[model samples]
Target: MKYKSFAVAIWGVVILLVILVPLPTVLMDILFILNITISLLVLLNAIYAKDALSMSSFPTLLLFTTLYRLALNVAATRLIIGQGDAGKVVESFGEFVGGNNIVVGAIIFLVIMLVQFLVITKGAERVSEVAARFTLDAMPGKQMAVDADLNAGLINEAQAKERRKNIQREADFYGAMDGASKFVKNDAIFGFITVILNIIGGFIMGMMQNSGASWNDILEKYTKLTIGNGLAVQIPALLISVATGIIVTRAASDEELSEEIISQLFTGPKTMFVAAGACFLLTFIIGRFFMIIVAAFLVFLGIRMQDSEQEKIKQDEKEMEERTVEEIRKPENVVTLLHVDPIELEFGYGLIPLADVNQGGDLLDRVVMIRRQLALELGMIVPVIRLRDNIQLNPNQYVIKIKGVEVAEGELLLDHFLAMNPGTAEEEIEGIPTTEPAFGLPALWITESQRDRAEMLGYTVVDPPSVISTHMTEVIKRHAHELLSRQDVQTLLDNVKSSYPAIVEELVPKQLSLGEVQKVLCNLLREGVSIRDMVTILETLADYAPVTRDTDMLTEYVRQALGRAITKTFITPDNSDVITLDPQVEQLILDSVQKTEAGSYIALEPSVSNKIMQNLLKLVEKVAQLGKQPIVLASPVVRLYFKRLTEQTIPGLVVLSYNELDPSVKVRSIGMVTCS
Candidate 1:
C-alpha cells in the first residue's frame, strides 16, 4: 500500500523525463506500450462502471493521461526529426499497420485522428458541459428532498448527512469533468499539429542528412516513420477519447453498460424476428450464404428468448399470487393502518394545481419551508406534512389535520390575490369579501388587474400559496406540543448531547426519566417558548429535578431560567402594559389549591371561581381597548394556577410570572384583576 503511491510518483517522474531528456528507443518502446495498456484499461473501466460517480477521478485521470501522451509525442518527435528513427513501436506501426504504403499509412492515421477529434471528443465535451450545468442546477431540489425525508422521519440524521455529502460529490465530479474535457479536446488538436510538424521536419532533416538519397527515397522513409509514430500514439488517444464519452454520458444503473445494453436491446423478441426477416430478404442482393446464415442465427436466438421470457412471466405471476394469499390470511397486516401522520393537508381536485409542480404549484416547496420556519422559531423539528387530494371536499376547499382529525379548513380563489385592509386602506376594493384563515381578519379576494390598486390603497396583498402557508405555520406553532413525542425529545437530547454532554448526562435518566423530560419540554412549547437553548433547559432541569419531579413545577423553574427569552417575547422596550393579579386573589387561589397523586389543581367553589373569571375577563378586555395584548402578571407561585384557571375560558391569553421577567424590563400595570 505504501509503495503504491511511490510507484505513481515514479510514473509522473518518468513522463517529465520523457518530455525534457533524450531517451533510448527501448525505453520509448516500453513507455509507448504502457500508455496503450493504460488507455485500454481506462476504456474498459468506464464501460463497466455502474455510474459516472464510480469513476469520479476519471476527469483528473484524463488530464494526467493527456499530459503523458503529449510527453511521449515530444520524445517520438525528437527521435524522428533529430535522429531519423523514433522506436520499434513507431517503425512497426508505420510499416505493418500502414501496409508499407505511405498513402495507406497516412490514410489510416488521418481516419483515427478525425474520428477521435471531431466525433468522440466533440460529443464528450458537449455532454460534459450539459451534465455539469444540469447537475449544479438540481442540487438545491435534491438537498430539500433529503431534508423533507429527514423531517418526515423516513431517514435518520446520519443517512440524511450522507445523502447530502453524495449530492455535493456528484456536483463536484461533473463540474471537474466539464473542465477536464477540454484537455482531451485540446490534446487531439495538439496531436494533429505535432504530426504535421513531425512530417515536415522529418522530411527536411532526412534530405539534409542523407545527401546521396533522392527526394522520393527521403520522403518515403521519413513519411513512413512519421505516420507510424502518429498511428501508435493516435490509437491510444482514440481509446481514451471513447472512454471520456462513455463516462460523461453514463447514467446511474444497477447493471454495467454491456448488461444494460443487451437487456434493453433484446427486451422484445418480436423485433428480433422482424430484423431477421429483413436480413433474409437482403441476402438476395448483398450476399447469398453469409446473409442467410446471419438471418438463421437471429431467428434461433429470437425463438429461445421468447420462450424464456414467457416462462419468467409465468413464474412471477405464480409468486405474486402466493404472496397475496399469504398477506390476506395474516391478521397482522392490519397493523400498518394503525399508524397516522402527525400533520396532513388534503385539498379538493380543483386545487390540485397548487400542489403540482408541473402546473407551477409551489405548495410542496412551501410545506418544506414551513417545517424550516417552525424549527427556527420553536427550536424543534416539525413533522413532515403529508399533502394529498381529497375527493369529498368542495372544489376550492382544503383542510389541515393533526393526527388524522381536522382542526382547520379554508377556501381559496386560486386565480385571485388575497388583499386585506390593514386599517389604513383609502377605499374598499371591489371584490368578494372573506376572512383571512390564519388570523381571521377581513380580506377581499381581488383579481390580478385589481392587485396594484389594492396595494396602492395600503392593503396587504398575498397570493393563494402564501395564504395557506401562513395558516399552516400558525397552526403548527399552536399545536407543536401535541406533535412532539418521547421519541422527538430523545432525538433533541441526542443532538445537544454532543455539545452539552454534562448537562444532558446529569439531567436525563439519572435526574429525570425521558417521559418526565418530555412533559417539561411539552409544557414550555404549550406556552410558546423557544427551546433552541437546550443547554439552559437541561441545566435547569438537573438543578430542580431532585427536589420535585412535578413537571408543572419543573416547567416553572425552566421558564425562570429562560426568563430573558420570555421577557423578550412579551415585553417590548417602549411599552410593557400588563394586568397584575391582586395579592388577595393570589392568596385565595393558594388557599383553594388541592393536590393528588396525579397532579394539583384549584378546588375553589364555582361561585368563587366565577368571580375571579369575571374580574380577569374585564381586565383582559380593558387591556384590549388600549391597543395592547392582554398579559396577566402574577407572583411565581400563583402564575401557573392562574393560567390554568383562565386558559379554558380565555384561550390564547398571555400569562407571565414575576420571576420570568428580566430585571431590566419595566412593567406598567394597566389594570388589576381582583375579587373585591
Candidate 2:
C-alpha cells in the first residue's frame, strides 16, 4: 500500500521527463514496448471483467495512458526529425513489417489509423456518451429500489449502503468515460499530425546538409521512418480504443466475455445443424474438399453439443429435485411458514404489470408514498406492505391484507379510465358501468379516447394505477391503528425522547405503561386524529394518569388537548354544523355506563341501543344532506361510549365533545339524536 502511492508519483514524473528531455533510441524502444504491453493488458482486463465496476478506475487509466502514449509520440517525433532514424523498432517496422515498400507501408499505416479513428474510437465514444446518460437517468429508480429492499428486510443496512455506493460508482465511472473517450479520439488526430510534421521536417533537414542525396532518396528515407513511427504508435492506440469500446458496451454478466459468447451463442444445436447443411450444399459451388471438411466438422460439433445439452438438463433437474427434498426435510423450514407480514397486497396475474417497475408501473413508488403520507398525516409509522401475485383470483382483482387476513379487495380495468360524476356531470359518457373501488361511488370505465370528453364534462377521471393507489391509501388509513404495533409506538417515543425527554420520561412507565400509551394512541388514530403532537399528548396523559389508569378515559383527555388540530381536520371554524346528543340521551348513556377492571362499557339494553342507533342514523343523514360532516357533539364523559356505540352503524361517524372543539370555532346544531 505504501509503495503503491510512490509508483504512481514516479509514473507522472517519468511522463514529464519524457516530454521535456530528449532520450536515446534504445530507451525510447523500451518505452514503446512497455506502452504496447500496457495497452494489451487493458484490453484483456476489459474482456475478462464480469461487470464494468470491476475496473472502476478505467477512465483514469485511459487518461494516464493517453498522456504517456502522446509523450512517447513526442519523443519519437524529436528523434526522427533530428537523427533521421527514430529507433530500430521503427526501422524494423518500416522495412520488414511494411516489406520496405513506401506505398505498402503508407497504406498499412493509414488503414490502422482510419480503423482506429473512424470505427473503434468513434463507436466507443458514442457508446460511452449513451451509457453515461442512461446511468444518470436511472439513478433515482435504483435508489428507490435500494430503499424498498431495505424497507422490506430483503437486505440489511450494510448491504443497502454497499449497493448504493456501487450504484453511485457506476454512474461516476460512465460519466467519466464519456469525457475520456474524447482523449482517445484526439490522440488519433495527434498521431496523424505528428507523422505529417516529422515527414516534412525530416525532408527539410535532410536536404539542408547537402549530403548529395537526390530528392527521391531524401523523401523515401523520411517517409519510411514516419510510416514506421505511425504504425508503432497506432497499433497500441487501436488496441486501447477497442478496449474502450468493449468496456462501455459490456453488459453485466456472471462470466467473462469468452464464456458468455460461447454459452449464449451455442446454447442450442439447431442453428449449428442448419449451418452444417448450408456448408455441405456449398461443396457443389465452391471447393469440394474445404467445404466438405468444414461441413463434417460442424455436424460433429453439433452432435456433441446436442448430447451435452441433454445430459446437462437431466443433471440440473436431478439437482433441483434433490435440493427440494433436502429443504423439505429441514425442520426449520416449517417455522418460516408461521411468520406473517403485518401488511400485504396480493393481486392477480393480470395486475402484475401495475406493480412491476420494468413495465412502467409506479405502484411500488405509490406504496412508498403511502407510507410516507400516513407517517405525516396520522403521525404513525405504517409497516411495509408486501406485494405479490395470486393465480387463484380473477385477473384484475387485488386483495389487501392486514396481519395475513384479507381486509379489503378491489378490481381494476388497466386500459380504461374510471370517470366518476362528482354530482355535476350533465351527461353520462358511454362506457362500461363500474363502482369506484375506493369509495364505492358509481363510475364508468371509459376508453382512453373518451377520457378527455369525460373530464370536460366535469367527471373526475383517474387511470388504473391511481385508482389502486388511492384505494390502497384509504385502506391503509382506515387500518393505520391496527398496523401500529407496540414496537412502532416505542419508536415514536424514542424519537420524542430525543427532544422532549422530560415529558416522555414522566408519562411512560411512571404514570402509564407502554401498552397503555399505545392503546391511547391507537384510540386517537381509530377516530381519525393525528398523534403528531406527542409532547402535548404526553403532558396531558401525565397530568391525568394519576387520577385514572383507564386508557379509554386517558385517550379522551388527550383528544381534548388536541382540540385545535382535530377541529381543523374535520370542521370549518367560521361556520360548522353538527348533530348534538340530547341531554336525556347523555344522561341515559351515563346511567348505563359500567366499569370493570379491564375497562368501561355502556350497559344499555339491546332494545335501547337499537333505538339510539336509529335516531343517530337519521340525524347523521340529516347533517349529510346539509353538505356538512356528520359530527356528534356530546359530553366528554359520554364521547368514548357514543363513538363505540355508533361505530358499527356508521363506521366513520365523528363524535367530539364540546371541549374537543377549538374555543374559537362556532358550532350550530342542525339536528339532535335522542332515545325518546
Model 1 lDDT on a 0 to 1 scale? 0.91
Could you estimate the TM-score for every candidate?
0.58, 0.55
Report clashes for each candidate as comma-separated counts.
0, 0
lDDT of 2 by residue, 471-499 (tens): 88888888878888999999999999999
lDDT of 1 by residue, 289-361 (tens): 8988888999998999999999999999999999989997899988977999999999999899999999999
lDDT of each: 0.91, 0.90
The top-ranked prediction according to TM-score is 1
lDDT of 2: 0.90
Q: Which stretches in model 1 have alpha-carbon errors above 4 Å?
A: 1-329
Runs in model 2 deviating more than 4 A are 1-324, 573-575
In model 2, residue pairs whose N, Cα or C atoms come closer than 3 Å (at least 3 residues apart or on different chains), thus clashing, are: none
